[model samples]
Target chain A: MKADIIVDTKGLACPMPIVKARKAITAMKTGQVMEVLSTDKGSLNDFRAWVSQTKNELIAHEEQNGEYRFWVRKL
Target chain B: MDEKSQKTTIVLFSGDYDKAMAAFIIANGAAAYEHEVTMFFTFWGLNTLRKEAAVRTKKGFLERIFGAMMPRGAEKLGLSKLNMAGMGPQMIKHVIRKHKALPLPQLIELAREQGVKLVACTMTMDLLGLQQEELLDGLEYGGVAAYLGDASDGKVNLFI
Candidate 1:
């Protein structure tokens, strides 16, 4: 899963990770993929909710060693 | 996106820094979700829009005292609890910075960047004797009707 841009939100709290992700996604072109690395536990649900609300596609998401990675494609 | 169907309105009535942060965070978050968002600042919440420098204005004795007691601007706001003469806000700011989290001002800026409407309650401004020049620029001024108009069809309405 390759991405056009990778945003590392590690160690950031709720809203910050989502805020940073939104900013990153906004800069990318449509159909481009963004990889977000966040350590916030709540991001699992936050990203899902964000994608649902914004109509963006969450192509892939996984958690490992307490880190959450999400691959989102801009709509 | 159906902008008309997805609307969020926040009535920020608290002057506390922590509460203000929460309001901005929620507002920014909703805006990120492609929702039309509006924030109405009234009473003490108007302090968040105040400028650091004092702007001279004619006011009654009560309004003068109100102005003197409240923090001049967002930068001077204290935490709602455990403020310890303002140490709490500083500590929280330090933590937010350490965590790479956006502070309230930055959050507000991001909200604006995301097209969130910032509205100042004109009635409260008059009551508190806050002049237009005393507040930060790029804000819409209106009374409760304006707020009610924005909040009426909003799917999410919050008072913080």
Candidate 2:
């Protein structure tokens, strides 16, 4: 899916990826989709939990070459 | 999100570097998720907020001794376990750098930037002979009443 903003968090560990993603998403407007690229394995669940808590729409997510990509729409 | 309902309160009572790091990580995460987070510093935890440079203050002999013994600032904190005469913290910092993880100081800064509240317990501060001038700026001074007020309204209240 096309993303309004792309955030690369590769090579970071644990909270940094999610932390950076949150900062990125905060700048986005409603209905805009943010794409986050993270290599941290823990971000998979972290993103899910964050999405659930924030009530933001998780458009889709996938993995390639161990990098996790998530598309989230600020609601 | 309802601002009132979206709050997290953490009571930091330990002086261990690892524990403080964990508290900050969670606090930052919660803040990022749109929760108002308050980390109350008490007892040994207050050491995390101390300034690195010595700030001379008038105090009794015992208080002066207490001031001299406590670690100043987040960087000086030692690990809770396997400290190995302070060698463990060095190893942990090295790995944190190698893994691209935010160290404790940076994490604390991020928390502050994200609007996480850092409150120092006034009662503890008095007991430990810590003066406001000795701590980092922009910290709130409060006792248990203040902490309880925030914690009661918080969705998650943790004592670290």
- The TM-score that candidate 1 achieves is 0.92
- lDDT (CA) for every model shown? 0.90, 0.93
Quote model 2's TM-score. Answer: 0.97
Candidate 2 per-residue lDDT over residues A41-68, each given as its tens digit: 8888999999988889888999999999
B65-149, model 2: which lDDT tens digit per residue? Answer: 9999999999999999999999999999999999999999999999999899999999989999999999999999998999999
DockQ for each candidate? 0.65, 0.82
Q: Report the C-alpha lDDT of model 1 over B24-89, residue by residue, as the tens digit.
A: 989988887778899999998999989888888878898788888889888789999999998999
Residues A1-75 of candidate 1 have per-residue lDDT tens digits of: 999999999998768788888888878899999999999989999999998787899999999999999999999
RMSD of each: 1.9, 1.2
Error (Å) of candidate 1 at residue B67 is 1.5
TM-score of each: 0.92, 0.97
